[model samples]
Target chain A: AQTVTQSQPEMSVQEAETVTLSCTYDTSESNYYLFWYKQPPSRQMILVIRQEAYKQQNATENRFSVNFQKAAKSFSLKISDSQLGDTAMYFCAFLTTSGTYKYIFGTGTRLKVLA
Target chain B: DVKVTQSSRYLVKRTGEKVFLECVQDMDHENMFWYRQDPGLGLRLIYFSYDVKMKEKGDIPEGYSVSREKKERFSLILESASTNQTSMYLCASSARTGNSNQPQHFGDGTRLSIL
Candidate 1:
């Protein structure tokens, strides 16, 4: 079984600053995928970024990037130049290379971007 | 653009009543998922379907069931609504295989309250 862990329960960052949310997972599968999802006040889950375990390079999507360390089993999300709209609950998820399309998600971290 | 739509944005049900949450995807995605989100608990998968008439149990599927009569529709059923089940329900869909890295697109969650 794969388990994703988000150690930070709540985080706050000033507007225009940068913040990093930490995530770690335990999985036996060598081939897998990691993802970060954001849920805003509207309750729509949006994709932030994703990383493939086989790839050594980290994934970046504009202001959102991931620091993926395969050996350490760590995948952290970084939000650069945070804005008020970035305030939301962030989740880390995992998908194994094999088996049914079942996703394992971590307890979310509530982020507040203060102006 | 890929879109996943949930039947209701807010629902209020009485305890012991039968509850049905409907989800439809227009992207011809083969994989459909139902997840429940509670405060601090993140999103917990309830059930998923890979094809029409094919359903699979997820991490927490004990009190729920699913129906997939068509390729693009997946429904989550709560046999008997309980207060504990009062939470936000999220529906998502994605391509079944090959493009596994493609993120799951989600609908605005339905907030369910059992009174």
Candidate 2:
């Protein structure tokens, strides 16, 4: 079985500051994918960033980046220059290439950007 | 941009009533998914379809059924709505690319309330 864990349930960041949300996962497969999704108050789940397990380089999208450590089984999201619009529920997800390609999601971290 | 749209943004149903939630993706994605989101549990996959008329049960498929008769449309059905089922339901679609790095495009979730 695969499992994803998000340690922090809630976090607050000052405007224009940086914040890192921690995530760790347990999976036996060597080839897989990790993703970070943001759900704002409007309840739209938006893809922030994604990383392939085979890639050593981390994935970065605009102001969001991920620290993916395959050996440690950890994938964390870092938001630089956080703005009020970044306030949302952040979820870390893991996907295996085998079978139907289902995603295993971690319990989310509610992030609030304070001005 | 990929667009995934749910038929309803909010819904209300009664106990023991059969409820249907509809989703459509315009990107011609071969894979579609339905998920339930709660306060701290993040998103739990209820069901998914890899192709038309092919479905698979996800981590939390109990009391839920899904239909995908068309490539662009997926429908989730609740046999009997319950209070516990009152949560945000999200629909997502992703291309069936051979690589595992494809990120899912999600719709604005439907907030369902059962009384």
Displacement of residue A107 (Cα, Å) in model 1 is: 0.4
Task: For candidate 2, write residues B14-85 as lDDT tens digits.
Answer: 999999999999989989999998888889999999889999999899999999988999999999998999
Q: lDDT per model, in order?
A: 0.92, 0.92
Worst 10 residues of 1 chain A by lDDT: A95-104
Q: What is the lDDT of residue B89 in candidate 2?
A: 96
Give residue A18's error in model 1 in angstroms: 0.9
Weakest 10 consecutive residues of candidate 2 chain B by summed lDDT: B94-103
**Compared with the true structure, what per-residue lDDT tens digits does model 1 show for residues A18-103?**
99999999988999999999988876889999898999999999999999999899999999999999999999999987765888
Off by over 4 Å in 1: B99-101
Give the residue spans of candidate 2 off by over 4 A: B99-101
**Residue pairs in clash, model 2:** none
Best DockQ among the predictions, by candidate number: 1
